[model samples]
Target: MRTPLTAGALLALALAAQPALAKGPATSPNEAATARHYASLIAGSQPNMAELTLFFTQMPKGGDLHHHYSGAIYVEQYVDFVDRQGYCVNKQTYRIETDKALVAAERAKPAAERNCLSSAEIYADDHTWRELLQRWSNKDFFNHGALQPPPDRLFFQTFGYFGPVSNSNFKEGLQELKKRAIAENVSYIETMFKLSPAVANPDFDAKAWQNANDDAAFDAQMRAWFAVLDKDPAFNKTIADFVARIVDSSEGIDDERFTMRYQTYVLRLLNPSLVFSSMVSGFKAAKSSDKIVGVNIVGQESTNISMRDYALHMKMFRFLKSVYPDVKVALHAGELAMGDVPPEGLKFHIDQALTVAGANRIGHGLDLAHETNATGIMQTMREKDIPVEINLTSNAFINGVEGSHHPINLYRKYGVPYVISTDDAGVTRHTLSNEYVLFASRYKPSYAEMKKTSYNSIRYAFLPVAEKQRLTRQLDQRFADFEAKIARLAKTAAKAP
Candidate 1:
């Protein structure tokens, strides 16, 4: 009886009104109180410590996407594992050493004294032992007494110092990290550890392409690397062995449902040609293996080589897209500052990472505010739906940025998607809970907003769509159960008065 326009308008009106009428209590009173308390905490009002602590503890963090496996294991734990294996620590450098020198040292010690100190005791010594932890990872920044190295040096040195032991037992290494994630109520870990073969070989030059120009030569070199990962049975056998080791070592542990994804990371500080080759190599590996999910450009973006190679890396990604169209990228961009590097760099990392490299996700986008034509980048990021991984403590500790200075709130304000991550929690002696607490206490996120952040991790993740949906449903049910428990506890506490 009615015209089509009239009927459509009427349906729209009804649909708009349905939610308000059907879902009565869209915002809970308790949620409002918690939001108010968060505001007070951010505004310098010391809210009840117990409630604040409870809020963070029960907050369900979705997943950690930016974790590094080696840096994720506590330094003390790594020391314990090695010492238990009867390894000797270098007294002068404090490096866990091997080869004849270390073996002789171990043999020289008295039988009763050798490997006798507990990890807890070793870590307690501030003068010699704790200093080793500081130097081997990112902990140097936290110690007021130690002479801290520059952020770039400290971060990269950690890898070289612990490289030997880390590679020795990747399977046991993963189990340790998985158990830590489960204890923290985290379900998935997409870590940046172990390199794809190209990044591993000693002959792979760090400075070979300082001036390389011939595209043909570069392609030839890439084909050789690809041959190793694709054609060589030995290389394939190594990957198979690593996977079996992880599965075998992780048997019989029922913590949180844990999963691992490889991020074939390239050192950005290499020559432009080599960096480009590594990018292509990483992408090829991702396409060729299920275990490898994505490619990452790691190392210090502040270095001259890295800065110079930035644009080329993006261009390389664009070229590789034709060869491996399905491979994903999650790059470390905008990890620099105006004070940290030249003006040219401060302006472009985010844009290049998103538009050129086709990054599905971005890591440590700390310099978002400083990028030039940033409005366009923000608009593009929002339109494209790329999520930036935010690491609160890592930013505060390594980059020396925090609170109001961090770009996280800006992303929230602009409606840009994001996920919270612990870039190197083990090094900082923090956990997912600590980062969530920092968000609640510092940024004043509502419980609903915090829950939204949790979901963002899985949603923004590179997991298969079906797997993502399954995990999302599981996470939602878990959160509902968590909220019900908190509600009952709140009622009991209120009734006590």
Candidate 2:
């Protein structure tokens, strides 16, 4: 008969099982002192926040792993796309319209004889330009309080305004994003963009698409569905074109100081059959080409349809994971907050996303505190090493979660893995560097925590084995270089004339 373990022993075992903090063994005393000295220099600089901003802007961020590719381009740059595509923008509503026939007809007329105003024409109207800017981004807005629609509504609506603009300028969007990432000293990005639409959905057994009777039944149902999809040449071409577009988008993008990969997503707010079918298509695309790294399910999680079908989507991911065991899934789970969603609505989203959906990483995870068995869910995440992609500005803009209510501190306490990201930098009018600055100023995390989180972003990225190793080494070198520069600056400033 074995003796039961003591409380201390059990506690130690449990602690050992949880994921470790990104912080490794402590640095030498001099290195620690130098870090503290640099922190003081940053904190004590003239016009301190500006200096702090500069510090973070120049800091070597590992990567932005939760970026939305379309949402990463600035609104002004998006306007440039509108010009290139010859799209029209409504002056009153600021909605961009792309009627090829209308454009052709207008071009056929004399320039002064045109009926509709093209986006270039709108840009020339200084009075109306700000309206399009505000419509497309969080510019001139402070918080949810200042937004016209509910913040969530406003945030999601920006995507619709630029949908037509985005399709025509994927390459431009990437080049701009890459330039911004390089400016911020970031090295890698896993940006989400929608893949081309899948072929027509097969005749749906709506019930069959909903919750599978059981795991085995789910497998049978999905196989039947795929059996139908597998026959369509249209579907095959669509998948190939989707994969080709991703590579095509990277044509002029420079990756010398930057590495980027695509995460194609299914908009989860659609019909259940469409959502699952898109996921199948997304997985196929990502698997067919290395250009696309993985697949995700996007769209607001708190709405009636999504909330209702949340578990079913997880089941869909679960079933798909069985088929493409190697295909990575980093889902947008637990993005809901208290007021945005009902209390019960928050309880099981992150839980199901982790357990049932087979999400390798969770995006946002704002509702971690409200999940049913929140503690247990965290423990499972810790044990499984599932990192949360924390999007600071996006959460602040959409969910009004920040300061003490934000979950990163709890994530720290529990040793749950997490990495900072820019969810929709263009829409939020922010960047990965802005996230670092906000976290540093708001949370007052130490330099070590900063380094750890930066490293963790690359460590937890969905890149392939060789790429992860290469980026990790690059990040390590970058960190060392940054630390030396900061320390030298601090020391030199102390002895200045």
Candidate 3:
């Protein structure tokens, strides 16, 4: 017993003498009480989702930064817009029938054969209503044995069915999103609202394709293209009009308590020329209006054009960013899985998005583990303070990436920052609260970490410093009130049998 202690024993004794490191920032009494209550709830082998849902529903989620405006609106609301706009749905295809002659002709058929049904007609038929909901969203997609396309296909295709009505009723749709966000204690939203107009140029495409891999040559060619666009009045006018439309659509969207900003996105599935031109337009729109806070590229990343020109698109973003360095970018990089594309495809998207495209934030960084130098990528993100937007429900539905297989575990292990978000709440038929419930039940993150994630949403937002500070202050008060309520609830429960 009195013999000399071994080196390992001595080191263990020294370390044990030191106090434990705190998990997160110091908390107020209410926060401490709330955290204790939350830990107990998630401590069991199977966490109580119902209780966690109620807990997260009352929690203050600072922002939803990865939302899509079209995808955020529920199918019920879109159907209402169809009724208001006098559009009929093709029952057979579930597509919006916009042609007057076609609708009239379809309406003339017998009730059994009338394929075009008005919104009211569709609602009256319970079977059609359920089917429409299933088509437009993830409703019953897992519960029923319906003939289904691939999950990703069904998810992306819903947009086309609702596109005709998505652009109309912007004010109404925005207000609806705002109302829902506030109800769930979300104070800010950065939504990818729409794509800026783009033009196709065969010559530009040829030149860009030629210099795709040569940075110096690509930069020169991009500058030449920019010069041409700079002098084009029609092109300049479109940017101005796009910005103006965003400004107009965002009327009454911001208030003392809530804020919403738009990101003008470019469709990556287009030709190189169109993609570059749209990227240019989105940058110009962001520069022209404060309401348009960022530019993003959104499309199915596994598509032929998107995959073939992926490197070129990053170069385009890099070049444009050189010119307009202040315009923020949040890209949908690594929104893919193993089977979605060839193995090589997953190895570079998240890396290029950060290093080449200069994305300040990344949406769906799902393929992080698949990237080459994956640890190095995570380290870079950690050192640079870049956060990934985690969409638990969306990733689960589309990519079958959830639980232990999800890269979020890797992110946590590597100290990379992440924020929970509802990528397309309406499309997934979930809410930010539901997202938090999933995060809590699955990851069992401490309340302090959960609160930090709420802050991270605002911190990584494409907002000015002052605006972020303002929202942060608001979040502080909201959390105080929320924790006090939770503390009271805990006290009451303690008194119960």
Clashing pairs in 2: none
Candidate 2 per-residue C-alpha lDDT over 79-128 given as tens digits, one digit per residue, 9 for 90 to 100: 77776887766666787768877767766877566545666777778767
Worst 10 residues of 2 by lDDT: 1-10
If the candidates were sorted by their lDDT against the true structure, best first, what order would they fall in?
A: 3, 2, 1
TM-score, ranked from best to worst? 3, 2, 1
Among these predictions, the greatest lDDT belongs to: 3
Pairwise lDDT winner, candidates 1 and 2: 2
Which structure is stronger by TM-score: 2 or 3?
Answer: 3
lDDT for residue 477 in candidate 3, whole number 0-100: 94
Model 1 per-residue lDDT tens digits across residues 1-497: 11222445534544553342223332655545544444454555454555666666666677889987777777766777665555656546766656655566666778555542334445655565767767776665755675777776777678676665666666667777777777767777788765544334434444335324555554465556655556667655555554454445445433337566667777777655456546655665666666677888788788787776676677567667656878888989898765788676788888888877788898988898887656566566666888889888888776779989999876776556788899877777788878887876777765557777888888987779987887788787777666666666666765895
Best by TM-score, which number? 3
lDDT of 3 by residue, 403-474 (tens): 999998777755677888998888888999999999889988888788888999999999999999999999
Best of the two (1, 3) by TM-score: 3
Number of residue pairs clashing in candidate 2, backbone atoms closer than 3 angstroms, sequence gap of 3 or more or interchain: 0
Whole-structure CA lDDT of model 3: 0.89
**Which has the better lDDT: candidate 2, or candidate 3?**
3
